[model samples]
Target: MNVLDLLEQWKQSDTFNNTLSDDHQVISYQEAYLRISVYSDWLASNSFTQPMAFYCAQSIEHLLMLIALMFNEVNFVLLPVKSTDVDKELFADQLTLKPHFCDMLRHIQLTKQAQCKTVATPGRIYFKTSGSLGTPKLVVHQRHNLIANSRNVLTRLPLNASSRVLIPVPMHHMYGFGAALWPCLLVGASIHLTSNLNILRFKAVERQFAPTVAYLTPSTVGALLLRSCKSSQYEFIVSAGDCFDRQTFQQAQTKFGRVFNLYGSTELGVVAIGEIQSKGEAVDDCVTALPGVKIKIESEQIAVKHPFGFDFYLYQQTRDVFFNTGDLARGDEITGFSVIGRAKLSINREGRLIAFSELESQIKQHQHIQDVALVKGRKDSKGHTIVAIVESTTELAPDELRRQLGKFLPRYATPSKIIIEPQLPRLVSGKINRKQIALHYEETEF
Candidate 1:
């Protein structure tokens, strides 16, 4: 069913009696509907026609704005207000500018705005990858994709009526919106939306709500472990979108009980799910694919054709039959698949190819390494040197980290530059803005 159909179903179900809550307030679905109705009335009164962009700042308002837009059939973009290295011009000429948010919409002078395409049908949600890396283009999904993507998570995961989900991730991200938020909405389960994701706020969420499910990333889990969180019980924690360190997974499993690894991307919904019990996973490192999702290891890269595949492009307006996830992997449909690394991120050091993710993952295994990001360094007559930007507590010398790296990686796989930093800049989705980091070093150090 489409978003409108789902909304209508919820209106008729007991879900209307349930509540949607955040850090600050709690409102029933009925109340949310009324507020959305008022906002819808406001939009209609103002003749809102352009494809809007909402600076989704973790609140009930952000959630309601999405719902209201979906109902109003307004094409929109959700930009995280706090993401690092975000292109300020990512939405230029593509959206009705700010000052249109909240109360300012009525006051802003009308300008030539980009008009949204008049589609005869519903379920056209627009999403763009974190634009730090390249020219950000909108990845579009239709109604069936929305439902199928949500169901892929809902079916595999064990959320129930009693479950209370703690969402520290932003709703703009597919990991957060599709996998985390959609299931809660579909199941009529309780959700506590946090204004920000941090150790203090995370503890506060647990202390206040006693939530059963948590949507987290590798970096957030690392932050929690670094803060020495108490061993807690959770139904399951889904980790996605980045290279989750094996050690961090063990620590998270110890702290949160069961940690489930969900593999997917913004272009495609979740491809697989696996439970981690210890430091070492299965030899194949298998993760079962969702029903109707066909996965193939074409030339060692994971390619998937699923119902949730982004059907249309907001700008290009074309459809891709299959999404070739640039990730490298090995497995059959029966054996499932394991992500090796991203094809584009592979570096050639002295003509010996080294997958950057493998190098970064190896470095992250260091006891002192809290977080690590890999970027290509200077190129001369020699070869392209791999750089490792590391986040650690104690002072680190390049030589020492190199020595540590020698223990795990081969000579060629060892990073050429070891820059110690207090922290690496990351997108709101928790993946390191590698393109930004590479560009920064290219300008300064190279």
Candidate 2:
């Protein structure tokens, strides 16, 4: 079903709260629906109909603009407001669409150009990855794929009409769009969008709204844990986009109880959800895949098949209909299945290859190591050197840690350099900032 149809359903529902907070500054579902209608009406007055670029910050106007685009049956690209002017210009040129800036003055001038498309045929939604790996490539998804994935995720999390959900992540990212926005829209759950990721702000909103569930990233979860907030406020806490480390999970459980760790990517919707137990053990891996969705592992790489799948672009051509995720996973009866690491990041020393996650999992077992990220450093005339950037609480001599790792991993697999740091840099999604860490080594005196 089209997302706009869901908005229509929400408009009719009286049980859900359309507004949140004492400020009453936040838009209610009813208010959002009306704004969407108004925006659609504005678009219809003009003749512009093709896909447009949506560049807006986190606000009521931004949310309504997105819903209006969906309702008007227009395919629009969601661009992060954090992007530079050059980046925005380049993106608009690449997509062959006019840029719609959401500032007060710009909004008035651009409304005339925001022509609504009258086509009844459903269009595709596009999201770009962080340009860390080359230029950020655009990933396309059909309406059906999004709806199916949303339905599949809801089946596992079990959100209903009465459920109040908090969306802490940015809507531009697929994790935020699929996990927070789409699920709430489809299930008719009340959505609470925070302007920013501040612990005090989030807690205050929680006390006021009392949402049953919250969609968050590992970094945001880490912040919540650092503050030692009460987790009993939310019944279900779902984390995605990055790995939920044991320390973060344990701290969260201390306050909030249990949280469901979800695994997926922008290319391959929601793949699995594992219940992380109190003892820091992933209890199950048998994620309930959506109907018509099949998982296959070829050469240790996980691939997915679905009737409604992403139409990825490769070398200027629309590649395969099926998505072969570059992630590595192993299927088993006990844990069911688990993602070990990304294929691109796996290190191969000489002829012997080893998964980065395997090394990380092994090193994390060590009491001294607070957190660690395994990466391929530099190759000498001999071979490639496996490097481990570790976040440690105390001084654990690199030599001593190297000896410890030797007990489990082979000499070649052990990281040649164990660089100790006060803390590890991480992306918004909670993945290690490898590029930033690599730069640190390059610029350091030692």
Candidate 3:
């Protein structure tokens, strides 16, 4: 069903009084609908003939604006308010949104020069990647596919009318907008949007809202472990965007309720999610693909065939039957797949290929190493030298780290050099900035 069909269903649901809240205030779905109706009416009067870039802030008003836009069938590109200059340059015309959002729409103005194509049908949404791995481009998903993606996630995950979901990630992201928020909207679940969340803020919101479900990233999970927060029993929690060590996962399971590892991307909405566990069942490392989504491993790289995948990248007509994710995986469809590393980042060491993600995973197993990134440093007659940048729980010598790693890794597999840093740079999605790190240390002497 499309977004409009979902909205009609929500209007007739018994849980119409379910609330959507943030730090500012709480509003029921009833009030939200009234605001959306008024805003959509205003949008109809002041129609935007060309595609405009939209700044989506983490607030209830922004959510309302999104719903209104979908209903009005306005073609727009979604971007975070704190977007970079490069992002703004992609779209010359902008749609400015303000506080008390609907009232400001009456005077909303669009600048000249449209860069994006306007779809004949409504419900087109574009989300760009963080460019952590490579150049960021706009990934387009039809409105119906987005709703279907949410349904696919719900089939694996459990959310109901009584469920209360706490979302700390930016709504502009697919992880938040598709996997989390859209699912809540479909099920009539309450949503609490937390902005600029930290350890202290997380604790405060927890005490106040008592959310039954939460959508978190690995970085947020790391923060909780660092703060030594108490165990919080909830329906379930889903973590994604990056991989963490087994130790971190076990520690998180102890502190929080059952934690599930979710694997998804911008092109394909919610590809796979951890299998649901019965009461008293242990959590598994394998994640099963959602219904109708096919997963295959080719040349150690993961490939996906998602029925509800995006149409295509903006200004590019390349669409493959099986999208090569560029990520390494090892598992059959029956057993489920586990993401190992990036296929493109593999480096040659003495004629032997090594996936740095596997190296980083092994390094993370060390008690002191909280996080680590293995990047290709330089190439010579010998081979490409591997450099390891580590974030540790305590001060540790680089020589000592190499010695510790040597016990498990072969002499050739050991990192040629190790750099100890307290904090490593990460993108908004919690993935390490390997591209940035590689560019920064490209000229370092091996």
Candidate 4:
């Protein structure tokens, strides 16, 4: 069913409660239903259609715009709030979708002239990657696929009329859509939206909303643990979009009590989830697969089969139904599985292939290294440098670290330069901001 039908049903039911606060405003089932209906009506009066581009920041307006589009069975391209002019132009040219800039506080009448013609009707939502790994690709997901995937996630953490879901990530990203927003909407749970990552704001939101659960990234969870907060503030925390380090996991457990790690990507939603007891232990086997979704490993690459998995881009030439996620994974009969690392990040230096994740794991083993990212840099006089951008707690000479890596890695694989920074810049999802790091190194003398 379309999102509007669900909303209409919930609005008439007694389960609707429209209580939300400025600090901790949560959309009750009823309020969410009413708001979505109002927005849908407004969009219908205006000329809104499927396959449009939504360009806006993370706010109530953003959420409402998405809901309106979904209600109308419109497929939208989510333009990141920080998108550059180049990004917008390229997206428009490629997708052939017209842009919709949201103005929430004001009601502006939209006309049919504003609507963009649909280029392709894959009957799915499209999301763009960060383009850090390479050029950004549009990932297509069916509405039913999302609903099915969300049902699987709900099996792990059931939602109901009494449940409140705190959304820390932007709705555009798959993590935000699958984990926080869609799941709540599916089960009549309250949704509390917060764009700020400030610890005080998080604490205040939790205290005021009393949300039963929340979705967070590793970096956000770490930051929350570092701050002063009561353990009883949250029942459970779900981490996704990036790996959760051991220290951060422990710190969160100490602060918030329960933490769960989610694994998936834009191509595949909610592949697996496990309770993180400590970072050192293997990720638990407990995982719930969405209905009609199947997982398998073909030559170490995580491959997925589902009715909804579509092309990397709407304009792309290739059309492979099964997605081959470039991730190494392992599974046992009893424990299920866990993703080891990305296949693209694996490097070949001096005739030896070394996984970037392995290199990162080794570097993070250092007591002073809080976080590190290893990327292949331009070939220098001493072969390809495994450049390491490190977030360090204490001073560590680059020469010394290079010497340490040489013992395990080949001489050629040893990092030629170790750029120490106070903190690693991260994407909104809290993954290492590789694009920013590349820019940083470009400006540096080394």
Give the candidate number with the greatest lDDT: 3
lDDT of 3 by residue, 254-288 (tens): 67667777888888988888842433333356788
Give the best candidate by TM-score.
Answer: 3
State the C-alpha lDDT per candidate: 0.68, 0.64, 0.75, 0.63
Weakest 10 consecutive residues, lDDT, candidate 3? 275-284
Ranking by TM-score: 3, 1, 4, 2
| Residue 188's lDDT in candidate 1 | 72
Better of 1 and 2 by lDDT: 1
Q: For model 2, where is the 10-residue window of minimal lDDT?
A: 90-99
**Against the hidden true structure, what lDDT does model 1 obtain?**
0.68
TM-score of 2: 0.68
Task: Kindly report which residue stretches of model 3 are placed more than 4 angstroms away from their true locations once superposed.
Answer: 1-4, 85-92, 99-122, 226-233, 276-283, 346-446
lDDT of 4 by residue, 386-442 (tens): 788889766667778667767765465567778777889999998998877767674
Pairs of residues at least 3 apart in sequence or in different chains that clash in candidate 4: 16-30, 21-25, 50-74
* Model 4 misplaced stretches (Cα beyond 4 Å): 8-14, 18-28, 48-50, 85-123, 227-230, 278-288, 346-446
Better of 1 and 3 by lDDT: 3
lDDT by residue (269-299, candidate 1, tens digit) is 6778776544346322357788788887878
